[model samples]
Target: MSLPVLTHCPYCSLQCGMTVAARAEDDGGGWEVEGANFPTNRGGLCEKGRSSAELLAHPDRLTTPLVRDSRREPFREATWDEALDRVATALRDTQQRYGADAAGLFGGGGMTNEKAYQAGKFVRVALRSASIDYNGRFCMSSAAAAATKAFGVDRGMPFPLADIARADTVLLVGSNPGDTMPPAMRWFAAGRERGATHLVVDPRYTASAAAADVHLQPVPGTDLALANGLLHLAIKHRLVDTAYVAERTTGWDAVRRAMRQYWPDRVERITGVPVRVMERAVRLLAESRATMILSGRGAEQHAHGSDTALAWINLALALGLPGRPYSGWATMTGQGNGQGGREHGQKADQLPGYRMLADPAARAHVAAVWGVDPDELPRPGVSAYEMLDRLGTDGGVRALMVMASNVVVSAPRADHVRERLGALDLLVVSDLFLSETAALADVVLPCTQWAEEEGTMTNVEGRVLRRRRAVEAPDGVRSDLDVLADLAGRLGRGQYFSADPQTVFDELRRASAGGKADYAGISWARIEAERGVFWPCPDEDHPGTPRMFRGAGEGAERSSTRGYFATPDGRARFHVVHHREPAETPDGEYPYRLTTGRSRAHYQSGTQTRRTKALLDAEPEPVVEIHPDLAARLGVADGADVLLRSRRGRARMRARLASTIRADTVFAPFHWAGEQTINALTNPALDPASRMPEFKVCAVDITAAPAGEDTTA
Candidate 1:
């Protein structure tokens, strides 16, 4: 019998540990997977993780390069060299015809750390293009922006997941770990054992809300109001930690003045969360010495997402929650490597190591690592949605390369995005399958899957874990690294790029040496020995920092004068914020608020999960979740088809009677494509601070499907 290779799951930020071994010839020809003991998952694997191996040998697995000369033509099998040459020629032509920014690269949060780093380097160095951004902008950019402004740094969860078990109370705002990341729920279960209560604030009674001690169902896009109300009550009830706020934070007075307007009554009127429920939430938070406030995409995917997140952070700061053991304000990162993806320059405005692209020093440091002049690096590019909107337009991206993202299905206002993509001069996509976005590509390069490649990924808690190769990739398929190297060679920049994962990671360490997300101390060997390592580890002997801004060294004694924050003056900032309406509000024509989220059985865009038989069987199609009262008003029956119309586009989905949802709102999972894709109806209003689109709420109208309307579209 072959020994099992220890590795992590390929889906979500949990990155649960698992083992894979080749099945005996007599048993089967594929690999068998089993959960392995790990701190994040604690030997638990979700349904998606368990069935991930199914993708390895699935029929949809792309094993060869495909290409076409025009959008109207069908894809034809081509050699790797032919495909690389075509992409290289197109990129060069686009840049030469227009400007360097004419070619854009769209990346995914699911990519490995090495691939993410390479993608950034490839665009800035080889193509010399400033047009590069990733899908992570849609995931948690608002939380990242808000946290960086208030706390000097953003590390998803500043503390470890185990800390949740030790907390006296956990306030989850706009996060649903129960369905999004099930393995991490064990920590909550552990907290329950210790009598720690959970408070969930969401528009719907989600799976996580069902398990919580309190559920605050506020109006969509009103998370800012709800958080402000809690802080107002905390101050009104004399529960503010005055000493901590006075000593450890700055700009609180302005925030305090701002909160004055958010009295319980006004907040209740704005958010539709009863005044009593607001008071109960405040009491629970104030009474607990150890409390955690965590936000997620539901809170951050808005036109004012940064302010919404800042409000939650202000509430936590007012209550003295951050920088303490078993307590802090954090955001739940959604994608598998969303935390690392942005840190390593996949983000539009960031250089490697979370450094600002506009900073000359950051540009110089990264340029030195790449053996290039600092001036050679291009300035920051546009955000993801803006880039997509500008495709093929004059003075915009004429050619686009997509890696691991299905933008046609995932981007907000996707139907328009599809049209823009169709207008592109050249579209190149690298993936494991022909996703909805890839189906329109002019060239498609087959890349290795997670279990078939070895690399690193930063998990939800910012711990970097290793993904080991369990089996060889099928013939004719190649890793993204190899494809990038070949393309760079074709572009006459091969010497600057390496196809090996370890070499790329070592280079990443050097480039990130002194930046905010320092990984100088983390070596591949050390990661293998320690299972995983948190970031900001500065030296070889230093233990990876599991927590941040706590006087540097582990458990080091600190003086009162030294504040515990990453801000310039060592004190966390408090931004004065106010609640605002979503970009699109429910109106007489569109009388319902539409919100979108994830399905327990599927991951982003449903590219890989939809191909797996087990997951597809579990969540066969997207469904519109509506309150029974609203369904009855619309004369819609459970399991009956419903036509949902929005200003952008329309989609048809089954009407599911969910009493847990608000009557004024409807919910849909954005895991499928075609007319069933809820993103088609989502608004693309961008946050000024984070450039994140408002995917959480939009105006929509619903009615029973007209007779003979095809649900298949």
Candidate 2:
């Protein structure tokens, strides 16, 4: 009998380890899944991870390339040669007719490091186009920008996940791992078991908040003010670490001045949290021996997302938490490869190794690795939202290639995005399933699923994990690497592209050798042997860095002497920020604020999970969670249809009356398509610094559907 193949779950940033074995039957059957005892999940699996195998043999899984001969024609099966030739010809024609920037590429955060690297390289080197970006721009770009500004480097977590259990107190801001990443809730449970206090700050009483010792229900998009208020109270009570601040930080005076205006009373009024409750929460964190501050999409998906994250980082700096053991500030990345995707050049302004594309030295280094002239690389293009907004417009991208993303269901103002997609001269999508986005493509290339691909993924902890292939891909399905190689060959850049994952990874290591997200010394064998390896592994003899910012202070070992930070002066910067209202605020026409988020059974856009029978059965359809008080006022009963309308668009879903959410707020799961998609009503206001859209908070109005109306239609 063949042994079970060890691999990581292909969902979420947790990258929970799992084992899969092929069944011995006369027919080619599906593989069996079992939990593998790895550090991130500790042998535990969530519903998404447990049922991930079902997607491999799903009925809707794409098995052949599809092509449309004309804009008005329906899609028909085509050979790989025909599809590749058509895609290559369209991209070439678009570039020749308009400019290099006329051709665009859109990638996804769920792609492996190798695939992402290849996709980025293919766009810049083969197509010679700067119009390249990925869905991660919408996922964690604000947090990444804020972290880079404050810490000089952006890593999802500077410490290990185990540190959560050792902390004396944890302040979770705008994150609910219970509903998003179920397996991660065990760390909080362990922390609670260790007598640690957990404080949750969110507009709604989420599952994590319900389990917390103190829940501070603040207004949506007021996270910055609430954080500043906590800092104000911490200063008022003289709970700050004065010496540590003086030694380890810069720009303290600005932060102090900025936080002074956020007094307890004013903050309470703005955040909708009582002053007493704020004080208690502040005291719990300030009095603890070690405190950790963690923020997520809720705090980083607004117009002021970067500033909001900076406020939280300022609080951590004031408390002397960063660089301290078991205490720090980190963003919880939502996508499986969100950390790695940004590191390996999928972002518009980034080169491999997280290097800035604007830097000549960085450009030269990467250009040398790709065997191209430094000037040959195209300049940085617009961000994700801007790229999508420019599709088919004059002086904009005329051709677009999407891989592993369901932008139709995930993009803000999704209806408008769909219209823009329709206007594109050419649209090519690669996926294992014909998602809403893929269905609109002029050509669809069938690609291998996660279980049939071997590559590495850097998780939220900055740990690089290996995902080994456990089963054979369906006949006629190809890996993204193969597609990229074929496309590169058609574009006359065949020598630079390789169909082998290891070859791409080798080049990625060289490209990323000395940059911020260095992976020069890591290998697949090392990852398998070590379960996973933390990055910054510069040499073969050097062990991976488990915890960052260590060995820079007293009582630390001398072997790892990389200092306390990656900043020029080895000190963290503190940004001074003030709170602002969301891009869209409630008014008479739109008296309620709408928020969109994930559910436990489905991930972003439900491209893969929705095809799994068990997962579909679990979360059969989308619904709007409305507070009972507001539901009563609107005549919306439990399980009744509610018409949610915003200035952008409207969606209809069943109402789920609950007291957990704020009376003025309505929550919807963004996992469905058509009229059920909450993104249809979301605002596309972008953050100035990060260009991240405000998908978290938007103004909307909800009304009960007319009696006997078919809302689901």
Each prediction's Cα lDDT score? 0.91, 0.90
Candidate 2's residue-wise lDDT over 297-410, tens digit each? 999999899999999999998888987779889999999998898899999999999898899999999999999999999889999999999899998899999998999999
lDDT of 1 by residue, 495-567 (tens): 9999999999999999998888889889999999999998877667878778775654537422122468767
Superposition TM-score, candidate 2 onto the true structure: 0.98
Off by over 4 Å in 1: 551-562, 710-713
Off by over 4 Å in 2: 26-28, 551-563, 707-713
Clashes of each: 0, 0
